[model samples]
Target: MAKIDKSLYSKEEWLVIRNRRRLEKQLKKQKEQISYPVKRKSSKVAFVLGNGVSRAFVEPEVLSKLGVVYGCNALYRTFAPDYLIAVDVKMILEISKSGYQNTNTVWSNHNKAYSNIKNINYFQPSKGWSSGPTALWLAAEHGYDDIYILGFDYKGLDDHSKFNNLYADTKNYKKSNEGATFYGNWLRQTKTVIRDNKKINFTRVIAPDNYQPIELNNFENYNTIHVGDFQKIFDIS
Candidate 1:
């Protein structure tokens, strides 16, 4: 690349140009860093794990044995799934500080801000989506015919008033007493994945009282099952 003639442009104009160039370079590096596993013809089942409280009683070890597992965010603190997806800067930093990224397959949007983290993989053409939906999308992209969504309660507990994550009150998370995080984005993103991947089957495992968004029911590819039945089917005692 030729040297930029900084003196030829106004300070503000130069700043914009510099930032654009920097982003382009970062995107290039991110593209190069992407590493995907070999797609197995026989690999048809996948599990996409979220941090919702409904799945608190479930063990990731049991699911890992059934298929490829992709977990989101703080799920890494407990069990390292086959692929861990975290987009939030704080959580990414926490994972990096623990040196988890050094030996694990973690994916995140490529940002110049995280240039210091050397081991994790960057998603090419970054989705800019939240971790749970991103994990779902990744699983769909891997050609899984059947994908089970675990812990995606999609709303708060206690009539949607309280925080409902398995990792609430822990590091990099809100206190259990805090109000629920908005679910609009998660619902829309999840619906988009289902719409885009019509061929893949998505079964959301929900507790009896789990909030069900009406929008999801419109998708033919999407379905839901009570957590009790899920446990019985999987023999997850």
Candidate 2:
């Protein structure tokens, strides 16, 4: 008879304890996020983009008025908006003793290993998704109505960048474990969802580009809230 690797069980138990403490801490702190709930304002959703150049155009003051600004981890470092949603654990933070690969934005909630946001939900990794649009779509599924995508540039080598690529140490990719899309990629997929679900009254706010604005306008019931500039349209007065 072969002996079982009993050592594996101890590591598994440790993971459970670690994950449990993390969840408990999140539940305790993030309850304050009720202030940013979609119900509080109604069917208005702002798809706050991360640190892409397009974000530079958003005019932060304008975005805040519509509702809660759920910016990416970059926002945590700079904007520090009312709500912050970090999708990948590895990207936003790196657990290294030497601090070799650590990039920007370390969570201030350093005491507890799991502390990220208060009341805001941390994205659990979804397997078999290609682009960041998958995450945005998931966000829509979670009930963010009138979705507005601010900065999803996807700008990198060959003008293609993955959500987690910014922090990757090695260039290996497996479809099983990667985060979602941003900018133009996120916008297009969201629009497709709206079109596919013909009967749904989906309001998607996005940047005004040459090709998209015209094509989307032709669609019958799709109410597209194409803004000149989020900063200007919202009138950050």
Regions of candidate 1 where Cα sits further than 4 Å from its true position: 1-43
Report the Cα lDDT for residue 68, model 2.
45
Worst 10 residues of 1 by lDDT: 33-42
RMSD of each: 8.2, 13.6
lDDT (Cα) of model 2: 0.45
Pairs of colliding residues, candidate 2: 30-118, 30-119, 131-181, 132-180, 132-181, 133-181, 152-182, 152-183
On residues 1-237, what C-alpha lDDT tens digit does candidate 2 reach at each position? 234455666988867866877897787665543222342454356454444443455566566667645455434434545444444444334322323214322222222344543332333322223234443444454455455555444433232433333323332222223443444544566567566655444444444541244555556645545455444556743
Worst-scoring 10-residue span by lDDT in model 2: 100-109
Taking the tens digit of each residue's C-alpha lDDT, what string does model 1 give over 18-128? 999999998887666554563353457998998998887689988888888999888888899989999999999999989999988899988777867889888877889
Measured by TM-score, how close is model 1 to the native structure?
0.83
- Shift of residue 200 alpha carbon in model 2, Å: 6.7
What is the alpha-carbon RMSD of candidate 2 to the true structure? 13.6
Which number leads on TM-score? 1
How does each model score on TM-score? 0.83, 0.45
